[model samples]
Target: MTTVAVFRPADERLDDAVALLESLGATPVPDPMLEVDPTGVCPREDADFAVLTSKTGAELAEAEGWDAQTTTVCAIGDPTADALRAAGYAVDVVPEEFSSGGIVSTLEGRVDGARVEVARSDHGSDVLTDGLNDAGAYVHETVLYRLTRPDGAGESADRAAAGELDAALFTSSMTVENFLAAATERGVREDALAGLNDAAVGTIGDPTRETAAAHGIDVDVVPERADFESLARATLAAAE
Candidate 1:
């Protein structure tokens, strides 16, 4: 059985990823790399459009009683859209590309001369805001949360360093960065990176793939869809 490493936050998402791996016959190493630290902030109410980049952002926004007022709501992907809808917010846009660049494209012509509010975590890429600004939209970003790596989060790094991990699913660039931070803290950065490179690795999107590449980690798979199941199955197949 493949021994795979995952780094989702400690939540239903992590549980679901583990369950999915088990259902697929892989032994999972659920090493959560992110812990959400809510910033107690919400989207600005005066914007013409509001964009949510993650399910966590949507949940936080909902908890803050964010009202659309006169703004159109948008999500970066189906997951975020579902979360917003579940919270009783009407999702008006979900880009086909399911990424910052994709959302930029989706709102390009429409957002010209519009006030766009972006609600997301602290580590959100500048691409979206810059793209929107360049496209003639006044963009304001609210940091809804900050992602911090939990203490003692490097066990999977040790396992990887020992050549025991068969695959790794990197859902975001921050996961890759936090995983490296964990490995470095364990004093196994070099060995862990070497072993990790030997195993099959999948990144959910191009941004994550690029981040891994910048660190000299060769990503073996990047599924067509930027989702966990697709990334895991594709990486496991590559590992075999």
Candidate 2:
């Protein structure tokens, strides 16, 4: 059986990833590499619009008692939109392309003079902030959480370096960065990357692809649709 490595944050998404891999006849290795902890950052209560790029940020907003109903909510994609909806926020906008650049494109002229609040991870990209600002929106960007790789991250990288893994699924750019950081910490960065080269590399979206490329990894599998099942199918196809 082909062993598929999933090194995402240990969250609600892990079960879905594991199940998707299993349904596709791949052995799922649930090696959660990262953990998300709240940084206690909160968005402004008087903002006219709120932005969410990831489900983690949405989760944080919900936990922090954000009154989403009073603010216009925008999400980058379906998953984040779904999360915001589940948390009682009516998602007003979801960019068609499901990316930060997409958000910039979608909200181009509409953000003028709007007070926008961006809630994301501690080290999130500033594309939305800059884009909204350029579009004349007053943006207040807040870091709702931080990502930290635990010891299991290094172990997962070690397994890959030992050639025990056949494929790796990356849902976000941060996962790639954290995984590589783990490999570097183990002093097997080059060897781990080399071993990964022999395995199928799967990415969920453009951000992950760009990040993987920056790290010199060629992505072999990409789904036309940005979803877990599509990614799983793409990974299986590339592995075969």
lDDT of 2 by residue, 16-110 (tens): 78877887899988877778889876666788888898888888888888886678889988989998888888999998887788888998788
For each candidate in turn, the TM-score is: 0.98, 0.93
Model 1: residues >4 Å from true position, as ranges?
none
Q: Which candidate is the best by lDDT?
A: 1
Candidate 2 global TM-score: 0.93
- Residue 44 lDDT in model 1? 97
